[model samples]
Target chain A: MMAVVTVAIAVQGNLFAVVVLGSIYSFLMATALVALDAVDVAMTEASVGAGISTVLLLGALHLVRGEEQKPRGRPWLPLAASVVMAGVLVYGTFGLPGFSDAGAPIHQHVVPRYLNDAVRETGVPNVVTAVLASYRGYDTLGETTVVFTAGAGVIALLRRRRRDRRDGDVR
Target chain B: MRNYLVLRVVAKIMIPFMLLYALYVQFHGDYGPGGGFQAGVIIAAAIIFYAIVFGLATARRVVPDWLVETCLAAGVLIYAGVGLVGILLGGNFLDYFVLDRDPVAGQHRGIFWVEAGVCVTVAGVMLKIFYMFAGRRREDDDA
Candidate 1:
């Protein structure tokens, strides 16, 4: 099913179609995550990726006309670079621990403590929340700051008034 | 067009419930998939729906610009204050253990307040962004 969606999207390269397909892909991935019991991450992905990001992108499309433009030249360098990266990833993943292996080092180490005592420690029933806001809080704080900085940049850029061409008066 | 009055009436009836549910998600985030971010977006969506149907002027009247700015700053300040408490208690940065007599309880206490802060900031930011975008539409229409 996922491959069908992927192939359909890959075949249809129009901008609007791409956006809709991407949104579908995002929601599907979120559903897969939920099925794997990563509900919190799934919720975040569905909301942020499928909902907000897609809405924002569509709004941007409204601002900019959607006309298909072809690249001037073949992007051979980027394609070759990505192929090398994919080859490295495939080689590396072959050496990875089997899926859902309890004996994996990840399951044995930091994850065990979070799984065992997250609720008792953080007073939050959502283990993801406990880990996000309590155990790994500094990282979340940094991410929030980055978002704030981006907002500030957008506000500064857009808040300026430009003179009207017809009226010879400032907006 | 006249028949759409029913839609308006339904929206008026439903919006309050939506806002309340957002708050419920914000506070109940400790137990469920929801948290600050989800709550923030939910609140923003409610407000956005209002603006879409009732007009931007109505939303401005409801949320007001200054309150949004204040909420954003207040959330960050609250989050930072928790870390400051850790510093005052002679623990490393954001060490919730020293906030209370019992380390476990302190951690819980600290996490709650910080999460609350995140909720406030997120809600504020979401509203602010909506206003900006909605405001742009007005400008475009004027042009």
Candidate 2:
């Protein structure tokens, strides 16, 4: 299902349809995350990908043409590069441990400590919350700063465009 | 959209519920599969839905630009302020263990405020981006 949606989005000519298909793809990805038992990731994917991005893309679409233009030429070089990268990624994954392997390196390290002691240490029932907000506070803070920076960049660009329009130099 | 009474009415009814759910997700994150990021986006989505149904001007009137900007900064301040407090109490930065007399309670206190800060900032950022895009379109229409 997700593969079909991805193909549809890739091939779609209408910008609006692409956006809609992208949203659907995000939804499918979120569902896949849920099936993988990564509820936190699923939630983030559903909200950020399917919800907020769809709206943002639609808003952006309003400022641009509604249809995608045909490619000026066949891009064989980029296609070959993409295929090579995909092959490398697939080759890289071969070294990974089996899915849900109990003795995997990751499970052997901090997983036990977090599962056994996170509640007692952080006083939060949800280990994910404890890990995100307390154990790894610095990382979350950095993530927040990234979001802040992106917001500032968008505001600056939009404000500059408005100013340009006011000065009769509209693009 | 303005002429679509059904859309307006449904949005009116749904926005409050959406907001309430966002709050629930925000505060109940410690026990569930949600937290500040999801809650913040949900809150922003509610407001965006209202804007889509009732028009951006009306939505902006309800949630003024100044307020959104304030939220963007204030949330970061709150998070950093808590960390500063930890340092003042002779602990390392963002040390939740020193937030209260009891270490466990301190952890709870720190996590709650940090999550609150995250919620505020995330909601603010989402709304700010939405405003920038929507407002530009409005200005183009005006000119």
Candidate 3:
């Protein structure tokens, strides 16, 4: 199902349909994450990817042509590079521990401590929240800063365009 | 959308529930899958839905640009303020353990404020982006 949506998005010429299809792809990906038991990730994917990005893309479509333009030339080098990167990524995954292995290095490390003592230490029933907001406070702060920066960037770009247009009118 | 009575009625009914759910997710994140980020997006989505149905100008009137901008900065301030308080309490930066008389209570307190900060900032950013895009179209139409 996800693959079908991705292929449709890739081949679609209408920008609106492509945006909608991309959101569908994100929804499917979020469902896949839930099936994999990453509920937090699924929530983020659903909200950011499916919900917000779709609106942003549709807004962008309004500012530009809806139909995607045909490529001026074939992208042989980029295709080859993508293939090589895919192959390398596939090769790299082979070195990973088996799925849900109890003795995986990751499980052996901080997992035990978090599971056994997170509630006692942070007093939060949800270990994920405890880890994110308390144990990993600095990292969460940095993530918030990044989101702030993105908002600032969008404001700069969008607001400045309006200002420039107004100045041009004055001239 | 303005002429479609059914659409407007349904949106009117749903918007409150959507906002309520966002609040539930925000405060209940400590025990569930949701957190500030998800809650923030949900809140913004509700507003955006309202804007889509009732018109952008109406939505803007409800949530003014200045308020949204304030939220964007205040959230970051709240997060950093908590960290500063921790330092003043004679602990390291962002040391939740020193937030209250009891370390466990302090942890809870710190997490609550930090999450609140995250919620505020995330909601602000999402709304800011939406306003910029929607307002741009309105300006273009005016010109």
Candidate 4:
């Protein structure tokens, strides 16, 4: 299902179709993440990747031409580069510990504390929340800063109207 | 789209529910498979749906640009301020243990505020990006 959407998005000539297909692919990916038991990650993917991004893309489409232009040249070099990178990644993953392996390096480390003692220590029944907002909170703080930065960047770039565009020009 | 009766009606009906669900997700994140990031995007999605059905002007009126700008910075302030409180309480930065006399309760307090900050910022950014793109199209139309 996802592969079909991926190919359609790549081959579709109409920009709108591509955007819709991309959204479908994101939904499929979110479903797969749920199956993998990463429900939090899945929700993020479905909402951010599928829901909000589709709207953003549509807004973008309204600003640009509706049709995707044909490629001017073959993409052999990039294709080979991507294929090689994919193969390397796959080969690297083969050496990883088996799924749910207890003796895995990660499980042997702070995972134990987060799993066993997090609830008791944090008084939060949800270990994910305990870890994200309490134990490893600094990381989330940094991520929040990054999200704000993105908003700031967009506002700076787009706040000027046509008349103000001339006035705001530094050059 | 403006003249499509069914589309407008459905969007109007769904927008409120979407906002409600966003709040549910934001508040219930502590116990479930959700958090600020997911809930924030959901809130932005609700407003974007409204803008599509009604108009950008209406949506902007509902969520003014100044409000978006404030949210964009306020979330970080909240998260950082919470950390500052930890320092003021004589613990290291982001030290939840020092937040309250009871360390466990302090952890809960710290996490709640931190998550709230995340939700606010995430929603703010998502809306800001969407408004920037969509508002540009509106300006082009006006010109």
Candidate 2 lDDT by residue in tens digits, A1-171: 988987888788999999999989998999999999999899999999999999999999998999999999998999999999999999999999988888889998888998999999888998999999998899988888888788888888888877877788543
> Cα-based RMSD of the predictions, in order?
3.1, 1.6, 1.0, 2.1
lDDT: which is higher, 3 or 4? 3
Q: Identify the superior model by DockQ, candidate 3 or candidate 4.
A: 4
Q: Against the correct fold, how does model 3 do in TM-score?
A: 0.98
What are the lDDT figures for the candidates, one per model? Answer: 0.77, 0.90, 0.92, 0.88
Residue pairs in collision within model 2: none
The regions of model 1 sitting more than 4 angstroms off are A7-14, A75-80, A161-168, B1-10
Docking quality (DockQ) for each candidate:
0.50, 0.85, 0.85, 0.88
Least accurate 10 contiguous residues by lDDT in model 3 chain A? A2-11
Per-residue lDDT of model 3, residues B1-143, tens digit only: 77899999999999999999999988999999998889999999999999989998898899999999988988889999999999999999999999999999999999999999999999999999999998897787688
lDDT of 1 at A4: 80
State residue A140's C-alpha deviation in candidate 4, in Å. Answer: 0.4
Error of 2 at A107 (Å): 1.5
Candidate 4: tens digits of C-alpha lDDT, residues A1-171? 988888788788999999988898999999999999999999999998999989889888998999998888999999999999999999999999998888999888899889899878988877878888988889999999999998988887676554486576655
Clashes in predicted model 1? 0
Question: What is the Cα-based lDDT of residue A73 in candidate 2?
Answer: 92
**Candidate 4: where are CA atoms >4 Å away?**
A160-171
* Model 1 per-residue lDDT tens digits across residues A35-135: 99988778778776786667666666666657557768997998899889999999999999999889998898899899999877766778888888889
